[model samples]
Target: MRTGIRQTDVLIVGAGPTGLALGIDLARHGVDALVVERGGTLTPGSRGKGLQPRTMEVYEDLGVLDEILAAGGPYPVGMIWQDGRQAGEHRMFDPAEDGEEGSRFTGPWMVPQWRNQEILRARLEQLGGSLSFGREVTGIEQDADGVTAHFATGEPVRARYAVAADGGRSAVRRALNIGMTGETVDPDPLLVADVRIAGLERTWWHVFPPAGEGAGFLALCPLAGTEDFQLVAQFPDGTDLEPLLTLDGVRKVVADRTHLAAEAVTEVGWSSNFRPRAALADRFREGRVFLAGDAAHVHSPAGGQGLNTSVQDAYNLGWKLGAVLGGRAPESLLDTYEEERRPNAAAMLGLSTAIHRDEARRGAKTRQLGLNYRESSLSEETRPAPGEIRAGDRMPDLTVDGVRLFDRLRGPEWAVVELEDGVFLVRPDGYVGWAGDSTEGLEGYRARVGA
Candidate 1:
């Protein structure tokens, strides 16, 4: 047990998208943050592949939108096949107008989960944030002042606060004894893999429905900016999956379901199998430690809400943590992280489950641009009767006084948005914090937010 007095303002567990994004946000704010990952390297495989329009805005704010756009492509139309022949084309999402309401991104963009994390890691490092791979946290102890994380092999970490972004089976979450209440969204298991195959065009997302009873569906989507295709296959509820996780097993699934030969699959990059489940932590925060990403909520992968929601969780908590740590705001501001994010996580969980059960469609809702915090405690709408845009609504990217709204809202400081109807105080996270016809109560809100 090597021991010394090493400390940071915040200690982030798990170098996934959530932790890395939070680290970047903290670094830019000049907060001392350290990120630790249990693994020796960044996690691989295209686990979450879709980035919604709202997330694109977040990436833009984080200064990685250009690389994200250059590294990925638009979702391809689904090509449905039947009896080894071309059947028809299937559109996965409902058609939405591009750049609606001044948003720069229209629909979902395809960037493999691995590549997404790589970009975020680079940005965090570029911002001077520190991250340590292979630092597996075994236990965590938090007092009234700070959190101390004991790892499996190395010196412990002491910080003013800590976050668990380590995934559904989080070690810190378990050490804290937080309960996860959820239901299985689907009984059948799903096998997802990244592979290289011949004779498959990259123009379409190839879909192969089950051939007969006892068979399951399969889909092969060409991953953008890579030579790999994300292969997904559904298995019968009780089928054994151990034999189906190998390269040969993947080839068998592809050849058995589609019109291709088993030999067409040339390489297998990564593979995994799991049953879809939706669960949420009993609470998002326990004392000085907070749960973000999959540590707080688990979602079925149907509507691509898991990753986006998780990333937003970091975004919501990052600014509050910064404000409180910097002594700009009262510590009470930290409570709003759970108050605002938990409910949204619950809603997205239901939406993902609905889409998985085919009870909902991939439409405007799936894009996540309409998500808001109208009911949050931070939202103060002073008007007796408000119009469509109310306090807590996301401020659009329209130009105000010849300056883009996002450009003005950039950085960790709150902005006084001068709109046509009224003046709105935009939170660093981009939501309208307060709105009034004049600056009458603006000072009070600013004081509360440490602005």
Candidate 2:
């Protein structure tokens, strides 16, 4: 490695929600990290528009939930249309019960992917983290000590640990020779575009089923906090629709699929086409390089789990990386990142695939609140008989001493919750690390985890 090369404690590739959220977590931990993006500006699109309840809690911990809620709104009811007339209403998400106790955020919040990234970037910058845009990682080299990321332009970055949050087509993951193995979730390619329409109402998510056999479905969802309506249309397998990303092409699709004319689409902001697929990397880590978000796992957008899962991936790795990099914990702690996240990502991938195939519904599973790490090596259940909430479960938000549980678990610290009967220790990422009738091994666990 060349002397005077740019250096940081952690090098995060990509500036999407995953990388930005991880950057925020590390920055708050006083870790020196740098985020590098291949593009000069943030990617533009309403790609992943739904934030699950678990992710809302993550945002709150990162100190950006207020901004996220202020910038987005609840998903509107789906309005079915037939013969150019109102047919009926369809609920896109499962209705939330009044005052759900386990979580404060009951339902998924609707926020465009671009807006979400912007908010995360803002929060990261506020924490004094640095992001280098237009810096593409062409290759990466790692050894026993650290990793070096070579760029297409500008100086290469040397960091104690490198994270590949650079999307599914991660250059660093590829350079490390990591293999992703999975099947295509769907054969039919889907076109998604953000556009401003003149005639569509923003009140409901407009849904148009297939007109006839071999036809496809079309959905125009009003993106909250913006004038753009996210247009999603399915096409036959092997359909060549790359040329349809143009403004005219989008307008033609909208006019042909619905009652609206081509002129109804006033402006097309961003568009892309993709076949829904679910894939997980063979391993989440290779030497000093760790893969996070889409770099490690890819999922269909059906259950809206891709972005949220990816963000949580970063959350899971952030604290571990911070601990090791800050010299507070042993390097062995980093291994748990792959241990805990890979299985969760695999499960979420199955859920997304199931939803895409219509074999499952977007209900409790899609909300991501039930996901746990009870099977993880770090989880310890010392109680004789645990209640509904056990070790490795997500710590439910409750008022203890008039302070919300989430309030105590907000920062990068282990929280010990004292309930009426037993005691529970919550990890920084909000999972119960230990549970027992008393604090029998709490000190040992705390010393081991560097809490």
TM-score of each: 0.98, 0.98
Per-model tally of clashing residue pairs: 0, 0
C-alpha lDDT of residue 182 in model 2: 91
Cα RMSD for candidates in order? 1.4, 1.1
- The ten-residue window of minimal lDDT in model 2 covers 92-101
List the candidate 1 regions with Cα displacement exceeding 4 Å: 1-3
**Residue-by-residue lDDT tens digits, candidate 2, 152-190:** 999888999999999999998899999999999999999
Total backbone clashes of candidate 2, pairs 3 or more residues apart or in separate chains:
0
Q: After superposition, how far is residue 427 of candidate 1 from its true place, in Å?
A: 0.4
Tell me which residue pairs clash in candidate 1: none
